[model samples]
Target: MDLIDFSAIATEHATRLKAIDPLLPPPGELPDDQGVLTAEASGSAALGVLSCEKTPADAPGAQWRALVEHRLDLRLAGPDPGTALGLLLEKWQERLAESGTERGDWETAAVVIRPSRDSTGSGELLRHGFAPVRVVAVRPAERHGRGPRRTPGVAVRTATRKDVGNVVELLLELQHYDAQFGVATVRESTERALTAEVEEVLAKDEPLLWIAEVYGKALGVARVQLPPASDWSKIYVDQSGRPKLGYLTSLNVAEQARGTGVGTALAEHAHQVFDTEGVDLALLHHALANPRSTPFWYAQGYRPLWTYWYRRPAVR
Candidate 1:
């Protein structure tokens, strides 16, 4: 068949499936909307659709943005999905040549249905190298519900200005502990004194700091700007009318306190507040290289909602 309108093709397929709703924004708008992508080539089966998403770092006022990278999706009946994926690979190679973007890690994925209904064909394509780069990366789902269960003796409490020094110290300690994992060893960062802007956050009635403590010793500290007055908060809102969820801007538990459950306690407490306030979700993102934090959040049920992409010189 002639080249199909690729841009609107996913939307059309989603519409045919009835999987998409009229109220929800068009395809690629929702954080988790997944569908199929098919090439226009005749004798080509539809390539599986990929759902792309990312979360945010638990830094004060930070927001998470989901990513959609459909350089190619081959999904159409009576055609070879593999052929379509191959075509996509070719197209991507072209992009790499034209744009100054370095090839990110080769990636590939299989189309998976939540319950495995009418999806035998899609699975097969993924098993084979339907696309170039061979989608082999396996990403964990974003965390949901409250968070990992509370760790005994680890109390998560809102921090006050008097606790600022202790909070900074814990953050520094936590960063240092991160060295074994190849992290550059945190500089015990964050300004020694709250900048004027940060001071305002502390002065506000709502909480500005979250600290995990035991016996009055702050083991870890995460900053937060409750009732986020930033664009990040607005993005968390269901611009499509989904319920609003409170934000978990940051969470940092000192090295000595990590496995002890300090981080979990802080997150759980945030979820509780969100639940009571009618907020629909609590979210954050960690750098891909930050292995320690990502697993910590996942065990708490935070699924990978989206991925934010960035590019810099490969050499430097």
Candidate 2:
């Protein structure tokens, strides 16, 4: 393997990912249309390829992610995939050190892998200090069995501008809980950003924001995007062509409301609205290690599509 055979690489990678999880997106015509640092395994039974790319800090969702991200994609065939991965990472780090750009506490080295896959290269990733941080989970538009029953005394309704304060409060609570898991960073700007986000949604003609209330007290909130708004998330789904995509961007329940069905009411209400509007799928991101959300989401019919594994500061 003197030269990289990208065509052969794409087929193997796509086949493996699909086999691991049917929801994994189909591989592009090429490994990646954009240029990246490519490394191939040598003196190994497995043929492994790792392509590394940097996502600048200013990109969308950068606030939650680190200042800059060095994201890698791995493709492997043959036995000993872990050894090949180790070699690829070694080469990648060598190139990074040679580049001489500072690797600090603000940068991240990340990989998005399917969680359902075998443990072929996971140990190597962990040795490199990568931790599973986030998951892109999705629920179909069709109902599975009976939907959640409306919680007693909880009135789910569209949120108005007057409800912005309560919305921000609940959203912050959600972020703070996630921060403990290292997936969320509650910066000084988080509250301001969340407030602006809530206000913007409320201003929409038909906002997809909903609040679950008990005796006029807002105990839960669900922010979602329909159709054109959710098209950005369609990238995570397989290339089945765009069906009407809906995103469950944010969901939170107050501490006092947990296990009382407030979260379920809000979630099922969003699904009802999405289904009524003819959405094909509903997508959301949750911290993989968050015990509460992991099981909560699974019980709601959402399954993991992609898992983002990352090492902070882009180094050990």
Q: Quick one: best lDDT, which candidate?
A: 2
lDDT of 1 by residue, 157-198 (tens): 777777756765664454454433331223222233223334
How far residue 262's Cα lies from its native spot in candidate 2, in Å, is: 0.2
Off by over 4 Å in 1: 13-25, 28-86, 100-153, 162-200, 223-241, 287-291, 307-316
Clashing pairs in 2: none
Whole-model lDDT per candidate: 0.45, 0.72
Query: Scored by Cα lDDT, where does model 1 land?
Result: 0.45
TM-score of each: 0.56, 0.87
In terms of lDDT, model 2 sits at 0.72
User: Can you write out model 2's per-residue Cα lDDT over 103-124, one digit (the tens) per residue?
Assistant: 6654555454544455667887
Superpose all Cα atoms of candidate 1 onto the true structure and report the RMSD in Å to 1 decimal: 8.7
Residue 100, candidate 1: C-alpha displacement in angstroms: 4.4
Query: Model 1, residue 146: displacement in angstroms?
Result: 8.0
Candidate 1's displacement at residue 28, Å, is 5.2
